[model samples]
Target: MQQPGYFAEDVLPLLASLPTWPQPSRKGATRDAEWILWVKMRMWNRLKAQFTGIIESDFKEQGLEEEDLAWIAGGLVDAGSATSTANFHNIVLYLAACPDVQATAAKEIAAVVGDDRAPAMSDVSPLPYVWACIEVLHRNTMPPWAIRHFTDADVTHKGFVSPKCPAVVCDTVALQFDEERYPDSFAFRPERYLGHTEFAGDYAAMADAQPRDHWTFGAGWRVCPGTRPAKSNLALMLANILWAFEIRPPTGAEKGGKGSAIDLSDDAFDMYPLRQARPFKAGFCLRLMLQEGLTVEAAF
Candidate 1:
């Protein structure tokens, strides 16, 4: 599905029109460019504020404390260092956009964990269903590439050989969507991991058969140190979203008939030629149960 808008539509055209050479002579042009960049920055900040407000509002309505809300937001913010904050923010924004996952997670948490107290990290862990949902989101929506590595010495993998300085890349999308690893690879079936019989005897062997294959957080020494903390934050946010709402396709949208069907062909971009695009849409409504018995709504 091609997103109707093109990359050059909004700001790119203006950026492309600017002078690129003889910089010292283009003082006025430089000032204009700087001003435009500042405006773009402000626009981004406003978007962030709006989403942050939504999350905060949800927390408040659940009778959570201001401090707890701040902690949750801060944990997400601090998961990546300053340089990676924007990437982390983008990930959170994508998660927020997925209404079905959010509603399911919130419902599960509310039923299993309850509203008498806020969820602790430990409380969030045993909910394998929630974690599996998070895994799917991460696998499906993660950036298409990680930083490329140049092998410093001869490297052998299986029978293949590569010399030093060969460019090595990680094709995350392919790894995540491999059909052999994930039978019915595109379906969103949380129960796939629910019971012992479903996975057979060896847990490790069963895990190997799924595209929960590689580390979405990269691998070895350079694996994202932030992976654990990031997952924790995601688990919490997802739990909250699930506990608070119900997700469904927008009215009049087509639904797969009776049996399981998944549309995995959603258009996406690769590392190079990156462009802005419209994402698939699903809508959500807050569950009334959350609102019925709540206290200290103002603090959150």
Candidate 2:
């Protein structure tokens, strides 16, 4: 059992006494489960040791006296919160603005989830279109650049050589929008991920060989371990939101012939120029929260 909530209440308050600015607010609703798991299972000793010599004795990092545990905790918090917000916001904008995609997802949800109380994690597999939609959102709107990385050793690309030890920024645009990987990368078509219709053969092979789950969660050791929870949150939120409401453009706006296709410019202010849709108003109407186990005759 992943009893992270209990660990947070019992374990975290004691760590603030250490010499770090502060551990981010890791309340029940706002904590990362993996982070808590690591702290509970792996790093419990450091917390128990506090300023004691147990840390100094066991883990000598580059001959340093003690490890900075607070910074580690902060990094986990930083990774989980902001990126999750951006991902969820981007998904909502795409779903609301693209009615075709939204309809497809809703139809899938209706068929699989079926006038349910609410969508659950188990329903994710049955909703592969929903999965593709999420992937498209990631591929289309990942951060303009990835976070900085330090070079471990000298590396050469083609004829040019980057020095052995300078920090380098990844060309996120080139990598994400690689024509070989994502044909017509600019267009928001989830079917490319599903490899259906016109996007058969190479695209399908690419989709299967290595699905572009995107570098937003990052890669390898620095990878965000919160992906499971993040996907769950996104999937459930999208399923329930689309299931419960009909999203429409604001009143008086001329919604081009197919009013569903709205302009999704990132005009909203962000702490670091985030990829968010502009503040366009969407009118949501109350739709039937379909009930399960009640047939037509039974309901009547």
Candidate 3:
């Protein structure tokens, strides 16, 4: 789970660059999915270009004007500098380096996805545990606020007037942690999204009707067009990393700090530029088949 800021700082920029990409002619809502896919592909391509640019920039610092074109021309290398690539890289790096959510994710992956094959986009859909992990990550490290926008027409909230063109801002973190909506709101219980429970019904409805509450992505008509693709990419990255490594707290250390317990409160925002996370440690290792060739590994 790459945290909410990663989407805003990295993924969104790459997605923003993609609208200019050439689109095939199509009519009506018939081609909606195709158009979405086209935009996604364009976003990914632009992200790759941006990542390449970052690599070039880093080389410039070392007195190298350009990356080795031969090496670069090789398709789909894991060079980690561009927007989406960097976002994924940061996530993988954090999972490898951070102790909190990383270990839990690895355990879930090992129990569900296994290591023989890396996770694919399709696999993410059936993996409720993985989805819950993503949700927790978002709740814990989301940006303090969403971008402010003005409504084109007047709106009312609780009988109060929100006059037309009034500036409106949404508090993302507050909404996710609201206890009335999310019971035991501060706890990192992935089960909240699993099984056929009351909240699960709400989750299904939200998945079907309104996805805005999944506010790691924004809202309304201008919401992230890259939401589906970004999620696919995120799921694949998380799954592969979990399948490949084991995460755990460092020896002689507690889950979060020296004699301090893991805090799921809003206070856990220190590691980000906008919010710093308390220092934590974890270890990683390759998982081996434990029984009769049946094993579970994490996927995104």
Candidate 4:
């Protein structure tokens, strides 16, 4: 996991201590499952410690008390890293499977962010196609459910009515795939979002933004606080990746098979509350060497 720049110094040790999952073995599937919870617990403990340290040392002037630390740590891990990792996993899977989309995005990135320098936030304006690809991926792979709201009182929307209820789920899968909203929705077509300047958060904020960009970031007053940084980080990552390498699925020889095919279906993802692509392979060939004077931090 990449540490947030502002807190990198304080959290570097925590990043180093992150747990590694046991490798899958012929007889280890069941055994690995039993220990996965333990690994997750260890990870959370390390993260919580790191967050507390940062809060006490770095943000001491903010006047936050000890009791607030656990809640903040949980939010940082669950609301930030987990979702970003899943999004990135989906991006790589889609790019490897769709060579044409990959090529188009790379071409656009090359035009706007030449090999002389790393991609910067300034390049976002001219790279609509790349953003479109990202939007499509977000729409397709969004969690099956968004934040669940318990009714504070009776309410109705459109034709449906609800009395006080324990939970009301906004079915993300249904909303994203509705044929009226996204024609031929299952196909990975970035063209649908061409000329759209708004990020997912922009759409989420609006009461009625036609051709809603995406719902990966939950909508309304409770929308994620990390949306802006997430968008910038995602753009920079994708731009730098396309600018520096050619992404493709592994060849048949590499897989020890006559032919190789990347699965781009629902079967490719694991059964997780947050959608995550299962481990798969993609090949990256260098296109442009790292430019002079670009630090590792800037390059990423």
Candidate 5:
């Protein structure tokens, strides 16, 4: 069924703007803009209506209010869509920038999932190299900071005192790039994660003694609920994309002879509350031609 697809365009910017603390003066303006967008776009209203219908038909006994249901559903949609899109964009950019890495992932996907159909969830377990690539890319491209968390009661760690009720942001980039944990720290090498089969969420859950894979998903009770699904979907997407096409940066001539060349460096990213790769040219060459109307299930 057709559904609203404008959350990225309408709601994400509002959400992102709400947390920006670059200047204390802009806080009021940001909230005003959010309210204006909420009224003008009515994206949340549309979602609320859709959810209301579902609850009326199937969950009337739960006594759930439409506003509560809408907020719950909207939270999931907003949380998943923006982050996932940014992540997928970052993956494509990384693949385009590093052809060798892409080639390695493609080979792994090819060995695990033949050209019969698109990749499926079942193929994820056998594709460790591809997962490594994703892990490395995520480490490099995740948002510099995580969602702001509050201090619960007065807390002291590392000899710093944080008063309760103040917003505390987890510095994700700093943790991920710690030289002690990630040797060389700045290089994009999937080899670091190779043979490491645990997902980020798994590592987040381990005891303090157990070395975690990455902090991209945060930790503790506030860890991203979509961690496992996001990883599976990413692996599936990487596999399918590698199976279907070869990704490359634009040609020198197309890039205006280095004057405006695609930037594979960290400078190409916009590090706000979310990490988003700026627009860059990339070429995708089709590597496989599937039968018309073919589905992943058809391969079985």
Candidate 6:
């Protein structure tokens, strides 16, 4: 299936003219512009059809206004895409750091997807470990704060009264690693969210109310609506990448692997200005044969 995009080449610039939207200068858009631009055109057409009519508001018949259109464009371009992109970066870093996990996922992809075609949504049902890696990535690298939420009514929970009309911040790090819920919260364990069959459909239910898998996408009514899409994108992306190439740390004259070149320094996780992940380096060499890699399918 084709992915969605923000908007048209010209219409996007017009929408982005809003004060809130950042007008990023177009520089070197041609490094790989041919296919990239074509893909974007298709995506833009897909999204354009959805915005022609009144956008579905939070109930109540509020017609789509100019401001609403701007908000929609902003939400599509930044709010949703940024976090998912960040998650992708974090997942890549995790796989580069942990070769064993990457190898396991690669094995799974080879078995289920084979070498003929790339991974797809249908292949997701059997690729639990790959999905588990995504879960682990979410748990390990969560946004410091989820989208700020406001309480609608005076509610009390665990002995505190959150009065109505007050902004609330979910301490995701604390909630995710609470000693009660997760025994070894600090450790990276994808298996924590695994064991359930058809995890693609099951994991989201676990995240609602009280998060079971991870807290990267937040929770409750205001939770990220792109949660499922983000996961699906992450899974398919990882599968496709692993299927085509064997990613490893840059090697040098020192003989063996020099370990992951990924730097998780202050600059690395400096998730400000749209939570953009700083660039990092990793080795990607095309694997000659994809199906040749298999390790006696161990049912975990």
Best candidate, lDDT: 5
* lDDT for each residue of candidate 6 in 136-246, tens digit (9 for 90 to 100): 666644455655678889998899998998878767778777888888775556777776343333455553545356656655556666667777777888888788877
Candidate 5 on 1-300: residue-level lDDT in tens? 012232332334455465456534356666776775555346557666665565556554677554455556666777788777888888877777677888888888888888788888888999999888778867753556677688779988899988889877767787889898888987768888886798777778778824777777777778888888888888888888889988766655665633223466768786765677877766666775333422221000
**Clashing residue pairs in candidate 1 (N, C-alpha, C atoms within 3 angstroms):** 105-242, 106-242, 106-243, 107-242
Choose 2 or 4, whichever is better by TM-score: 4
Tell me the spans in candidate 3 whose CA falls farther than 4 Å from its real position.
1-112, 156-159, 195-213, 252-267, 271-280, 289-300
Per-model tally of clashing residue pairs: 4, 0, 18, 0, 0, 0
Q: Deviation in angstroms for 122 in model 6?
A: 1.2
Pairs that clash in candidate 5: none
For all the candidates, what are their Cα RMSDs to the real structure? Answer: 13.3, 12.3, 15.0, 11.8, 9.0, 10.2
Candidate 3, residue 53: the lDDT equals 64
- How well is each residue in 92-181 modelled by candidate 3, as lDDT tens digits? 434544556666666776666676677777677666666665545444433346556899998876999888997677666676777887
Best by TM-score: 5
- For candidate 1, the C-alpha RMSD (Å) to the true structure equals 13.3
Give the Cα-based TM-score of candidate 3 against the true structure. Answer: 0.51
Worst 10 residues of 5 by lDDT: 291-300
Q: Candidate 6, which segments miss by more than 4 Å at Cα?
A: 1-49, 53-64, 140-142, 196-211, 254-268, 273-277, 289-300
Residue 44 local lDDT, model 3: 53
TM-score of every prediction relative to native: 0.52, 0.63, 0.51, 0.70, 0.73, 0.68
Which sections of candidate 5 miss by over 4 Å? 1-69, 156-161, 252-262, 289-300
**Model 5, global lDDT:** 0.71
Error of 6 at 33 (Å): 30
Q: Which stretches of candidate 2 lie over 4 Å from their true place?
A: 1-67, 156-160, 179-181, 195-213, 219-222, 253-261, 265-273, 289-300
